[model samples]
Target: MTVTTQPDYRCTPSPLHAILLAGTVPLFLGALLSDIAYYNSFQIQWTNFAAWLIAGGLLFAGLALLFALANLIRADRKAGRPVMYLVLLLVTWVLGLVNAFEHAKDAWAVMPSGLVLSVIVSVLAVITAWLGLSNLRSGGAR
Candidate 1:
Protein backbone atom coordinates (compact mmCIF):
# COMPACT_ATOMS: atom_id res chain seq x y z
CA MET A 1 0.00 0.00 0.00
CA THR A 2 1.22 3.54 -0.85
CA VAL A 3 0.35 6.64 1.16
CA THR A 4 0.33 10.17 -0.19
CA THR A 5 0.32 13.40 1.77
CA GLN A 6 -1.53 16.53 0.67
CA PRO A 7 -0.24 20.03 1.11
CA ASP A 8 -2.26 22.68 2.87
CA TYR A 9 -2.48 26.18 1.50
CA ARG A 10 -3.80 29.30 3.19
CA CYS A 11 -6.57 31.20 1.49
CA THR A 12 -6.63 34.16 3.83
CA PRO A 13 -4.66 37.27 2.99
CA SER A 14 -1.58 38.18 4.99
CA PRO A 15 -2.06 40.91 7.59
CA LEU A 16 1.67 41.32 7.86
CA HIS A 17 1.90 42.44 4.25
CA ALA A 18 -0.14 45.50 4.97
CA ILE A 19 1.66 45.93 8.28
CA LEU A 20 5.08 45.91 6.71
CA LEU A 21 4.01 48.05 3.79
CA ALA A 22 2.34 50.65 5.93
CA GLY A 23 5.34 50.71 8.22
CA THR A 24 7.64 52.45 5.73
CA VAL A 25 8.68 55.26 7.99
CA PRO A 26 12.30 54.31 7.59
CA LEU A 27 12.01 54.34 3.82
CA PHE A 28 10.45 57.76 3.94
CA LEU A 29 13.24 58.95 6.20
CA GLY A 30 15.80 57.49 3.86
CA ALA A 31 14.36 59.47 1.01
CA LEU A 32 14.48 62.61 3.10
CA LEU A 33 18.08 62.06 4.09
CA SER A 34 19.02 61.07 0.59
CA ASP A 35 17.81 64.42 -0.61
CA ILE A 36 20.20 66.07 1.81
CA ALA A 37 22.98 63.74 0.86
CA TYR A 38 22.45 64.46 -2.81
CA TYR A 39 23.07 68.10 -2.17
CA ASN A 40 26.16 67.47 -0.09
CA SER A 41 27.62 64.88 -2.42
CA PHE A 42 27.12 66.83 -5.62
CA GLN A 43 27.97 70.27 -4.24
CA ILE A 44 24.46 71.28 -5.20
CA GLN A 45 22.44 74.03 -3.65
CA TRP A 46 20.00 72.90 -1.00
CA THR A 47 17.36 75.31 -2.28
CA ASN A 48 17.58 74.21 -5.89
CA PHE A 49 16.26 70.64 -6.06
CA ALA A 50 17.10 68.44 -3.09
CA ALA A 51 14.74 70.23 -0.75
CA TRP A 52 11.94 69.84 -3.25
CA LEU A 53 12.56 66.12 -3.50
CA ILE A 54 12.49 65.69 0.23
CA ALA A 55 9.37 67.81 0.53
CA GLY A 56 7.61 65.82 -2.15
CA GLY A 57 8.47 62.49 -0.57
CA LEU A 58 7.27 63.72 2.79
CA LEU A 59 4.00 64.97 1.34
CA PHE A 60 3.27 61.77 -0.50
CA ALA A 61 4.19 59.52 2.40
CA GLY A 62 2.12 61.52 4.85
CA LEU A 63 -0.90 61.53 2.57
CA ALA A 64 -0.62 57.85 1.82
CA LEU A 65 -0.43 57.03 5.51
CA LEU A 66 -3.48 59.18 6.21
CA PHE A 67 -5.49 57.60 3.42
CA ALA A 68 -4.62 54.08 4.48
CA LEU A 69 -5.64 54.82 8.04
CA ALA A 70 -8.86 56.42 6.86
CA ASN A 71 -9.80 53.37 4.83
CA LEU A 72 -9.22 51.06 7.80
CA ILE A 73 -10.90 53.27 10.35
CA ARG A 74 -13.91 53.79 8.11
CA ALA A 75 -14.24 50.04 7.84
CA ASP A 76 -14.79 49.96 11.61
CA ARG A 77 -11.25 48.81 12.18
CA LYS A 78 -9.79 48.70 15.67
CA ALA A 79 -6.55 49.95 17.24
CA GLY A 80 -5.94 52.60 14.60
CA ARG A 81 -6.29 55.92 16.39
CA PRO A 82 -3.32 55.36 18.62
CA VAL A 83 -1.15 54.89 15.58
CA MET A 84 -2.52 57.92 13.80
CA TYR A 85 -2.03 60.03 16.88
CA LEU A 86 1.53 58.94 17.19
CA VAL A 87 2.18 59.70 13.55
CA LEU A 88 0.97 63.20 14.16
CA LEU A 89 3.21 63.40 17.20
CA LEU A 90 6.10 62.31 15.01
CA VAL A 91 5.32 65.08 12.58
CA THR A 92 5.43 67.62 15.37
CA TRP A 93 8.74 66.27 16.55
CA VAL A 94 10.13 66.51 13.03
CA LEU A 95 9.00 70.09 12.70
CA GLY A 96 10.74 70.89 15.96
CA LEU A 97 13.89 69.21 14.77
CA VAL A 98 13.86 71.23 11.57
CA ASN A 99 13.55 74.46 13.50
CA ALA A 100 16.25 73.46 15.93
CA PHE A 101 18.55 72.44 13.11
CA GLU A 102 18.47 76.03 11.90
CA HIS A 103 20.70 77.21 14.72
CA ALA A 104 21.78 74.54 17.16
CA LYS A 105 25.03 72.68 16.77
CA ASP A 106 24.40 69.00 17.22
CA ALA A 107 20.74 69.86 16.89
CA TRP A 108 19.55 66.37 17.69
CA ALA A 109 21.43 66.52 20.93
CA VAL A 110 20.28 69.96 21.97
CA MET A 111 17.81 68.45 24.36
CA PRO A 112 18.70 64.98 25.55
CA SER A 113 15.10 64.39 26.54
CA GLY A 114 13.89 65.36 23.07
CA LEU A 115 16.24 62.87 21.41
CA VAL A 116 14.92 60.08 23.61
CA LEU A 117 11.36 61.22 23.15
CA SER A 118 11.75 61.31 19.38
CA VAL A 119 13.01 57.75 19.26
CA ILE A 120 10.22 56.55 21.52
CA VAL A 121 7.62 58.36 19.46
CA SER A 122 8.97 56.94 16.19
CA VAL A 123 9.06 53.36 17.51
CA LEU A 124 5.54 53.64 18.86
CA ALA A 125 4.32 55.09 15.58
CA VAL A 126 5.81 52.27 13.51
CA ILE A 127 4.57 49.50 15.79
CA THR A 128 1.10 50.96 16.13
CA ALA A 129 0.90 51.60 12.41
CA TRP A 130 1.84 48.00 11.73
CA LEU A 131 -0.69 46.67 14.22
CA GLY A 132 -3.43 48.86 12.78
CA LEU A 133 -2.68 47.89 9.20
CA SER A 134 -2.44 44.25 10.20
CA ASN A 135 -5.90 44.38 11.75
CA LEU A 136 -7.23 45.92 8.56
CA ARG A 137 -5.85 43.40 6.10
CA SER A 138 -6.48 40.00 7.69
CA GLY A 139 -9.93 39.45 6.26
CA GLY A 140 -12.19 36.48 6.94
CA ALA A 141 -12.32 35.64 3.29
CA ARG A 142 -11.66 32.20 1.91
Candidate 2:
Protein backbone atom coordinates (compact mmCIF):
# COMPACT_ATOMS: atom_id res chain seq x y z
CA MET A 1 0.00 0.00 0.00
CA THR A 2 1.18 3.50 -0.83
CA VAL A 3 0.26 6.63 1.10
CA THR A 4 0.43 10.16 -0.26
CA THR A 5 0.28 13.45 1.62
CA GLN A 6 -0.91 16.72 0.18
CA PRO A 7 0.25 20.13 1.26
CA ASP A 8 -2.12 22.32 3.18
CA TYR A 9 -3.04 25.62 1.57
CA ARG A 10 -3.75 28.79 3.47
CA CYS A 11 -7.14 30.33 3.21
CA THR A 12 -7.78 33.65 1.50
CA PRO A 13 -7.82 36.72 3.69
CA SER A 14 -11.16 38.12 4.87
CA PRO A 15 -12.72 41.33 3.60
CA LEU A 16 -11.66 43.14 6.71
CA HIS A 17 -8.06 42.23 6.09
CA ALA A 18 -8.32 43.34 2.50
CA ILE A 19 -9.85 46.64 3.48
CA LEU A 20 -7.27 47.27 6.14
CA LEU A 21 -4.40 46.56 3.82
CA ALA A 22 -5.88 48.60 1.03
CA GLY A 23 -6.87 51.58 3.13
CA THR A 24 -3.88 52.01 5.40
CA VAL A 25 -1.52 53.75 2.98
CA PRO A 26 -4.09 56.10 1.54
CA LEU A 27 -5.42 56.98 4.94
CA PHE A 28 -1.96 57.68 6.23
CA LEU A 29 -1.21 59.87 3.24
CA GLY A 30 -4.46 61.77 3.69
CA ALA A 31 -3.68 62.40 7.30
CA LEU A 32 -0.24 63.63 6.38
CA LEU A 33 -1.67 65.93 3.77
CA SER A 34 -4.16 67.29 6.24
CA ASP A 35 -1.39 67.92 8.70
CA ILE A 36 0.60 69.76 6.06
CA ALA A 37 -2.40 71.88 5.19
CA TYR A 38 -3.04 72.74 8.78
CA TYR A 39 0.55 73.57 9.51
CA ASN A 40 1.01 75.65 6.41
CA SER A 41 -2.24 77.54 6.82
CA PHE A 42 -2.42 77.53 10.61
CA GLN A 43 -5.91 76.04 10.42
CA ILE A 44 -7.01 74.44 13.69
CA GLN A 45 -9.89 72.63 12.06
CA TRP A 46 -7.64 70.80 9.61
CA THR A 47 -5.47 69.53 12.44
CA ASN A 48 -8.53 68.14 14.19
CA PHE A 49 -9.53 66.37 11.02
CA ALA A 50 -6.04 65.00 10.58
CA ALA A 51 -6.07 63.68 14.14
CA TRP A 52 -9.29 61.76 13.60
CA LEU A 53 -8.09 60.43 10.27
CA ILE A 54 -4.89 59.12 11.78
CA ALA A 55 -6.78 57.57 14.68
CA GLY A 56 -9.21 55.79 12.40
CA GLY A 57 -6.46 54.48 10.14
CA LEU A 58 -4.48 53.26 13.12
CA LEU A 59 -7.50 51.37 14.43
CA PHE A 60 -8.09 49.58 11.15
CA ALA A 61 -4.41 48.83 10.54
CA GLY A 62 -3.97 47.52 14.07
CA LEU A 63 -6.90 45.16 13.62
CA ALA A 64 -5.51 43.94 10.32
CA LEU A 65 -2.12 43.29 11.84
CA LEU A 66 -3.68 41.27 14.65
CA PHE A 67 -5.61 39.20 12.15
CA ALA A 68 -2.49 38.57 10.07
CA LEU A 69 -0.53 37.53 13.15
CA ALA A 70 -3.26 35.09 14.15
CA ASN A 71 -3.39 33.59 10.68
CA LEU A 72 0.37 33.30 10.49
CA ILE A 73 0.50 31.56 13.84
CA ARG A 74 -2.16 29.10 12.75
CA ALA A 75 -0.76 28.43 9.29
CA ASP A 76 2.79 27.66 10.29
CA ARG A 77 3.39 27.08 13.97
CA LYS A 78 7.13 26.55 13.68
CA ALA A 79 8.07 29.19 11.12
CA GLY A 80 5.39 31.82 11.58
CA ARG A 81 6.93 34.06 14.16
CA PRO A 82 6.36 37.64 13.03
CA VAL A 83 7.93 39.42 15.93
CA MET A 84 9.34 42.35 14.00
CA TYR A 85 6.06 42.97 12.30
CA LEU A 86 4.25 42.90 15.59
CA VAL A 87 6.71 45.26 17.20
CA LEU A 88 6.59 47.69 14.32
CA LEU A 89 2.82 47.65 14.29
CA LEU A 90 2.67 48.21 18.00
CA VAL A 91 5.09 51.09 17.77
CA THR A 92 3.14 52.59 14.93
CA TRP A 93 -0.08 52.31 16.85
CA VAL A 94 1.37 53.96 19.90
CA LEU A 95 2.99 56.75 17.94
CA GLY A 96 -0.18 57.30 15.98
CA LEU A 97 -2.22 57.53 19.14
CA VAL A 98 0.15 60.09 20.61
CA ASN A 99 0.21 62.04 17.40
CA ALA A 100 -3.56 62.10 17.24
CA PHE A 101 -3.74 63.37 20.77
CA GLU A 102 -1.20 66.08 20.05
CA HIS A 103 -3.06 67.13 16.94
CA ALA A 104 -6.31 67.29 18.86
CA LYS A 105 -4.69 69.62 21.36
CA ASP A 106 -3.02 71.67 18.61
CA ALA A 107 0.42 70.79 19.88
CA TRP A 108 2.10 71.56 16.58
CA ALA A 109 5.56 71.61 18.05
CA VAL A 110 5.67 67.87 18.51
CA MET A 111 3.49 66.78 15.61
CA PRO A 112 6.24 66.62 12.98
CA SER A 113 8.11 63.79 14.60
CA GLY A 114 4.89 61.89 15.11
CA LEU A 115 3.95 62.38 11.49
CA VAL A 116 7.32 61.06 10.38
CA LEU A 117 6.93 58.09 12.65
CA SER A 118 3.47 57.44 11.28
CA VAL A 119 4.81 57.45 7.71
CA ILE A 120 7.53 55.00 8.61
CA VAL A 121 5.07 52.75 10.40
CA SER A 122 2.60 52.91 7.57
CA VAL A 123 5.25 51.87 5.06
CA LEU A 124 6.36 48.97 7.19
CA ALA A 125 2.81 47.87 7.80
CA VAL A 126 2.09 47.94 4.09
CA ILE A 127 5.11 45.79 3.36
CA THR A 128 4.28 43.32 6.10
CA ALA A 129 0.62 43.13 5.14
CA TRP A 130 1.51 42.59 1.51
CA LEU A 131 3.85 39.78 2.41
CA GLY A 132 1.27 38.21 4.69
CA LEU A 133 -1.41 38.43 2.06
CA SER A 134 0.86 36.95 -0.54
CA ASN A 135 1.75 34.11 1.74
CA LEU A 136 -1.90 33.42 2.36
CA ARG A 137 -2.68 33.44 -1.31
CA SER A 138 0.30 31.27 -2.22
CA GLY A 139 -0.43 28.66 0.47
CA GLY A 140 3.05 28.98 2.12
CA ALA A 141 3.30 25.21 2.21
CA ARG A 142 6.46 23.39 3.03
Candidate 3:
Protein backbone atom coordinates (compact mmCIF):
# COMPACT_ATOMS: atom_id res chain seq x y z
CA MET A 1 0.00 0.00 0.00
CA THR A 2 1.25 3.46 -0.88
CA VAL A 3 1.11 6.15 1.80
CA THR A 4 -0.36 9.51 0.96
CA THR A 5 0.49 12.75 2.71
CA GLN A 6 -2.16 15.22 3.80
CA PRO A 7 -0.43 18.01 1.88
CA ASP A 8 1.78 20.70 3.36
CA TYR A 9 -0.20 23.38 5.14
CA ARG A 10 2.51 24.85 7.25
CA CYS A 11 2.94 28.65 7.51
CA THR A 12 1.09 29.61 4.36
CA PRO A 13 -0.38 33.11 4.86
CA SER A 14 -4.05 33.53 4.08
CA PRO A 15 -5.38 36.85 2.85
CA LEU A 16 -7.34 37.34 6.04
CA HIS A 17 -4.35 36.43 8.13
CA ALA A 18 -2.37 39.09 6.41
CA ILE A 19 -5.16 41.58 7.03
CA LEU A 20 -4.93 41.06 10.77
CA LEU A 21 -1.16 40.99 10.80
CA ALA A 22 -1.24 44.54 12.06
CA GLY A 23 -3.76 44.03 14.86
CA THR A 24 -1.28 43.50 17.64
CA VAL A 25 0.09 47.02 17.54
CA PRO A 26 -3.26 48.78 17.52
CA LEU A 27 -4.48 46.42 20.17
CA PHE A 28 -2.07 48.04 22.58
CA LEU A 29 -2.94 51.52 21.44
CA GLY A 30 -6.63 50.78 21.80
CA ALA A 31 -6.04 49.50 25.27
CA LEU A 32 -4.51 52.81 26.11
CA LEU A 33 -7.37 54.72 24.54
CA SER A 34 -9.92 52.61 26.34
CA ASP A 35 -8.16 53.25 29.58
CA ILE A 36 -8.19 56.95 28.96
CA ALA A 37 -11.78 57.00 27.84
CA TYR A 38 -12.85 55.00 30.81
CA TYR A 39 -11.00 56.69 33.64
CA ASN A 40 -9.15 59.82 32.70
CA SER A 41 -11.69 62.55 32.25
CA PHE A 42 -13.86 64.75 34.42
CA GLN A 43 -16.85 64.32 32.14
CA ILE A 44 -18.21 61.17 30.55
CA GLN A 45 -18.56 61.17 26.80
CA TRP A 46 -20.43 58.48 24.88
CA THR A 47 -22.81 58.08 22.01
CA ASN A 48 -24.82 55.18 20.68
CA PHE A 49 -24.63 56.39 17.11
CA ALA A 50 -20.85 56.40 17.19
CA ALA A 51 -20.84 52.92 18.60
CA TRP A 52 -23.32 51.88 15.96
CA LEU A 53 -21.10 53.28 13.28
CA ILE A 54 -18.23 51.29 14.72
CA ALA A 55 -20.33 48.16 14.64
CA GLY A 56 -21.15 48.77 11.02
CA GLY A 57 -17.50 49.28 10.10
CA LEU A 58 -16.49 46.15 11.93
CA LEU A 59 -19.17 44.23 10.08
CA PHE A 60 -17.78 45.50 6.82
CA ALA A 61 -14.25 44.65 7.87
CA GLY A 62 -15.35 41.12 8.63
CA LEU A 63 -16.72 40.81 5.14
CA ALA A 64 -13.50 42.08 3.65
CA LEU A 65 -11.55 39.58 5.70
CA LEU A 66 -13.79 36.76 4.59
CA PHE A 67 -13.31 37.74 0.98
CA ALA A 68 -9.57 37.72 1.43
CA LEU A 69 -9.69 34.29 3.03
CA ALA A 70 -11.63 32.86 0.09
CA ASN A 71 -9.17 34.34 -2.32
CA LEU A 72 -6.28 32.68 -0.52
CA ILE A 73 -7.81 29.22 -0.12
CA ARG A 74 -8.13 28.07 -3.68
CA ALA A 75 -6.90 24.51 -3.47
CA ASP A 76 -3.48 25.68 -2.57
CA ARG A 77 -1.10 23.87 -0.22
CA LYS A 78 0.08 27.10 1.43
CA ALA A 79 -3.19 28.47 2.69
CA GLY A 80 -3.64 26.69 5.99
CA ARG A 81 -2.20 29.35 8.26
CA PRO A 82 -3.88 32.18 6.42
CA VAL A 83 -7.23 30.44 6.77
CA MET A 84 -6.80 30.09 10.52
CA TYR A 85 -5.78 33.68 10.87
CA LEU A 86 -8.71 34.85 8.77
CA VAL A 87 -11.12 32.91 10.96
CA LEU A 88 -9.64 34.56 14.00
CA LEU A 89 -10.02 37.95 12.37
CA LEU A 90 -13.65 37.19 11.56
CA VAL A 91 -14.33 36.17 15.13
CA THR A 92 -12.68 39.29 16.46
CA TRP A 93 -14.59 41.47 14.04
CA VAL A 94 -17.89 39.99 15.17
CA LEU A 95 -16.96 40.33 18.79
CA GLY A 96 -15.93 43.89 18.15
CA LEU A 97 -19.43 44.68 16.99
CA VAL A 98 -20.95 42.90 19.95
CA ASN A 99 -18.78 44.75 22.36
CA ALA A 100 -19.67 47.95 20.62
CA PHE A 101 -23.43 47.49 20.78
CA GLU A 102 -24.25 45.03 23.52
CA HIS A 103 -25.89 47.28 26.10
CA ALA A 104 -28.49 49.72 24.96
CA LYS A 105 -28.43 51.63 28.23
CA ASP A 106 -24.81 51.36 29.29
CA ALA A 107 -22.71 51.61 26.17
CA TRP A 108 -20.37 53.96 27.95
CA ALA A 109 -19.71 51.29 30.53
CA VAL A 110 -18.54 49.09 27.71
CA MET A 111 -15.14 49.54 26.17
CA PRO A 112 -15.14 50.82 22.64
CA SER A 113 -15.41 47.71 20.57
CA GLY A 114 -14.66 49.92 17.62
CA LEU A 115 -11.38 50.65 19.25
CA VAL A 116 -10.69 46.96 19.37
CA LEU A 117 -11.56 46.64 15.70
CA SER A 118 -9.36 49.55 14.82
CA VAL A 119 -6.51 47.87 16.53
CA ILE A 120 -7.39 44.66 14.80
CA VAL A 121 -7.39 46.35 11.46
CA SER A 122 -4.19 48.20 12.18
CA VAL A 123 -2.21 45.18 13.30
CA LEU A 124 -3.62 42.93 10.66
CA ALA A 125 -3.01 45.47 7.95
CA VAL A 126 0.56 44.42 7.38
CA ILE A 127 -0.15 40.73 7.56
CA THR A 128 -3.09 40.97 5.20
CA ALA A 129 -1.16 43.18 2.84
CA TRP A 130 1.70 40.70 2.78
CA LEU A 131 -0.62 37.76 2.28
CA GLY A 132 -2.23 39.52 -0.64
CA LEU A 133 1.14 40.39 -2.06
CA SER A 134 2.32 36.81 -1.70
CA ASN A 135 -0.78 35.46 -3.38
CA LEU A 136 -0.15 37.80 -6.26
CA ARG A 137 3.43 36.66 -6.38
CA SER A 138 2.28 33.07 -6.78
CA GLY A 139 -0.52 33.97 -9.18
CA GLY A 140 -2.82 32.18 -6.77
CA ALA A 141 -5.41 34.92 -6.75
CA ARG A 142 -8.30 34.26 -9.13
Model 2 Cα lDDT, one tens digit per residue, 27-109: 76678878778667876777777777888878877887787677657654434324444555566667667666666554566
Residue-wise C-alpha lDDT for candidate 3, range 29-134, written one tens digit per residue: 4433543454445233533443444445465456667665665666354435456456655665665555455423364554454455445644554354444335
* Candidates' C-alpha lDDT: 0.41, 0.65, 0.48
Give the Å shift of residue 7 in candidate 2. Answer: 4.9
Pick the winner on TM-score between candidates 1 and 2.
Answer: 2
- Judged by whole-model lDDT over C-alpha atoms, candidate 3 comes out at 0.48
TM-score for each prediction? 0.36, 0.70, 0.47
Per-model root-mean-square deviation over C-alphas: 9.7, 3.8, 7.5
Candidate with the greatest TM-score versus the true structure: 2
| Two-way lDDT contest, 2 vs 3, winner | 2
Q: Who wins the lDDT comparison?
A: 2
